[model samples]
Target: MFPWGDSDSELIEVQGPRAAIAKPKSFHAHGVHFWEIGSDKRLAGAILHHCRSGIGKLRACTGGDQLALFKIGITHDYDSRFDLYRSHGWEKMLVLFYSSDLGQVEMLAPAKHVAAIAAAFAKTSSDGALSAIARCPQNDAERAMQKALCKFDLTLDAPVTYVNVGEQCLVPCLKPTDYVRTLNERGYLHRLIGCPIDSSAGALSEFWARLSKAEPQLEVCQDLADGLVDPRTLIPVYIHGDGGRTYKHDELMIFQFQPCMGHGTMHSRPVKPNSIGVSLKGHSFTTRFLFGVLQKAIYSNDPSTFERFLEHMALDLQSLYHVGVKHERTGVVFKFCVIGVKGDLPFLAKAGNMNRTFLHIRKRPFLPHSPEDPPSFFKLDVLHLYHLGVGRDFGASSLVYLMTLYEAESIPKAIEKLNSDFKSFLLSSKKVVHFKQITKDLLGYISSKAYPVGHWNKAMDTPVVVQFAEWLVEKFGGESTPDLLIRSGCKAIGVCMRTMLSSALWLDRSEAKIVGDAALHFAQCYGKLVHYFSRKVSACTIWCQNYIFGTISH
Candidate 1:
């Protein structure tokens, strides 16, 4: 609840642990005066705002990584200039600090916690003498602003010295082998530690130059490290160590090396019952990250939750990769759903059942607030797989499913009818429900006998994908204009109708009823797709489970 830093005027009273040691009231690198707080109440409000926006983590990435990298050896005097520390590192350090425009810091760690960090920073100070100042640009427009602003007789660039935050000589190894060696380098790999540097702290570029010098053998470090500390580095930094509080303004302690390719298997040897440690249910970093994401999604309604849900779903799927129930033929009938007809039935049943379960779990009254929808590409692929199963012969199954719903004793006649209907649907079919387009498409397929093959037309045969693209344009293209939405919707409907023609290619005389049943089932599954977007339920896991079970249970 106290203000941060020191100031001569009574107007800026900071009543916190580091209140005495904070830099004097002055403009931070971004040209904002942050040295004052009207009262403790204002600071409290700032804390609350931070919690809501999750800006603490967000800024940690910016100020912690970006800024730390920028001010490697830079030292501050007037709170804005850093010449003393800069002089120590052979002019390698440069510093700049920018207050976020998004909002105030939202993290309100306990005062004791914050105090610890402030206290640590305060201890690293030299004599209370102002060092030579450094000039900075006002904005991007004028490159000469820094030189002009130095009228206070500040230097543009000066000598700097690096702070040694502990270093270990690393005789790096090669790829997979080097990976293991790197882990041994930390001795206690489980409890390793490293210093954090903010890449955007205006000192990143300079700090990067110095860190590079520390590892001359890793010439790649000299080359690639520069890329790592560039102002544009947005990669998340997960450090490890004790004393997170002391690094509040600059550093943090987090997990060390993250295993990439064969990571799960690598840890398999270390933990007993490896499934518990590395599988979906365990205490692995991903699992922990997932839980955090879920907490945010459920409690804070963060949009990022959707992304996390899919990731968790993927892990669940990976866990099920080789699992199966033994049987002589196709074996055990795992309780899953049975929808659609023939080849289409299996996929539709699985997809529908999976989506339904997700919806059931998320039983809540809420309007659609997200901009994303379930992936249509996957759905179309499933549909394509169904088509391939019926057969490739354009004379029979293929034409009916690929073109329109008409009876053609011959292939040539069916092809002509399908082409005519396609042209018509593309031009007309406006203001129709998606299902209506499917019906029209089926009719056209029955009329045509020729089935489409090859990639180009095969792509067009996917009505749902085409409709999804059109729908996306309507919802997000430019400024969601009414006219554009209507036009986009019309095109979407047309594509759906044209694509429905594919169902005909799969129908035969005896299979007519089967096809009818399949159509009904396809409709039911398609309804699930629509419902998923409105409800925001994830279907991938459900799909995987049902695929394994053979019976899709919702």
Candidate 2:
């Protein structure tokens, strides 16, 4: 991808992630060569590295919003400069944020560029022989840095901005109402406002149909998707929260708003989402942006220090639900409830502070929400529950069964041979497998608490096992040898998995019904195979069927 502007300009070819280690290449920035900026190449090189990252990390409170600190100043021997600060007793220096071009920072083109540089780079040091052209002493350089920051009136001090709680690591943000105001003022809502909203369930697309059926108190987006009522600017909203980390306990949670409406997933779309709030409880800050989407607002939340983030977030959501916020300038009434939430089970439970097993029928968490009769939210995550859980179980267990046919002296020997074939098959198909070796432990074959299921920790390697199973059946299937039922089951389930994950946007009733019946053929075959091995098969849970029928029926 090209930079934001001027694609014709000279560009640096940075190494892609596939490389073992990328060799740094010299480059220029803002019309100045980085290597030529200073005399000491070591210090100059450090600046280049830190420009991509941070130098020293500290905290600052700007307008009562706690933020990651950046000290822009001229310095020599950058290491010693930070050491003095540490000796004087400050929060332990973590990562670094330093820049020598303090006074000259204002010369940057856009005000936004100024803020972005300060967020990432902006270092300080007492002694540097040569630095950003005309480098000065520490104290004077810091004053220049502070002056530049103040001149822009950034740091979320603008009236429309909010405190940062590491909220999406936004370089700059706007308050929630201001965010809506900006969008509305810019005419992003032009087509949406006062537009005819489809409330009829039959006329609705899958997105709205499923939503309306799930709650059914009122039509799906009427509370947010309408502007027909005079003097109102309704903004339909979908709040999505996510875990910061995967394959382990999440470090923190992130919430963003993706303004969505219209018929189906593909019939229409909205601008990308932005951050509204974040939780940063003394953990080191994270700088990863979500798909490079610009975040609008930050509500600093740390469970210990900034404990009221969630409370404030709920209050803000409630305000949106109740009287709809008025645009500061336009005075348009923008009303929208969080008509829907899109997130995985873990993130949903954590954000709502509900029981981990949310589908177990418990007291409702919100004011107007009551437990569904069969939990409409049980829509199967085809990737996880199927590809990662049950499908993976069948795949690995089937592989283990194939291993037994090898008649190796030990289970380990059987496993080794099976994995060799598995790896070769996946490699031939140009798929990468993360696991070094597959073992009985990973398949949970030794466990009595549950059936022989795949309990692999890394969720990413799921596809390899899945493809391997399908390949094994394809390569070894015969009515006289391999179980014909199991072989068919593999092919059927693979087809169903691919169908469920299809990118197709719209579907007719017959097509939906066919896809709904698709998984059943394999599930039936799988059950028979399970019974053949275990002598009994547990009934498929109602929720899975409910999801299949409810969604298809929708």
Number of the top-ranking candidate, with lDDT as the measure: 2
Candidate lDDT scores, in order, read 0.29, 0.43
My TM-score estimates for the predictions, one after another, are 0.17, 0.48
Using TM-score, give the best candidate's number. Answer: 2
Candidate 2 lDDT at 364 equals: 26
The CA lDDT at 409 in model 2 is 100
Candidate 1 at 128: error in angstroms? 35
RMSD of each: 28.3, 16.5
The segments of candidate 1 whose C-alpha lies over 4 angstroms from its true place after superposition are 1-179, 185-554
| RMSD (CA, angstroms), candidate 1 | 28.3
For model 2, the superposed segments whose C-alpha errors exceed 4 Å read: 1-215, 219-238, 241-311, 318-336, 347-380, 447-450, 456-460, 478-482, 503-506, 536-554
Compose the digit string of candidate 2's lDDT tens values, residues 1-554. 01111332222222221222222353322111111122222232233344432222112112222454334453433345555765665333222222344433323223233333444443553322212312322323433444554554422231333444453442323334444444445443322221222221222233344444546553323432353322124444545554454222424455455444432222223212221111111111111112111212222243321223333344444555456655444555656544444455554544454322222222222223334433333333344556555666666666666675667998788788887887788779988766667888887777332456677756556656766766776676545323666677777766664543332333347646666676787777665566555533244333233432343221
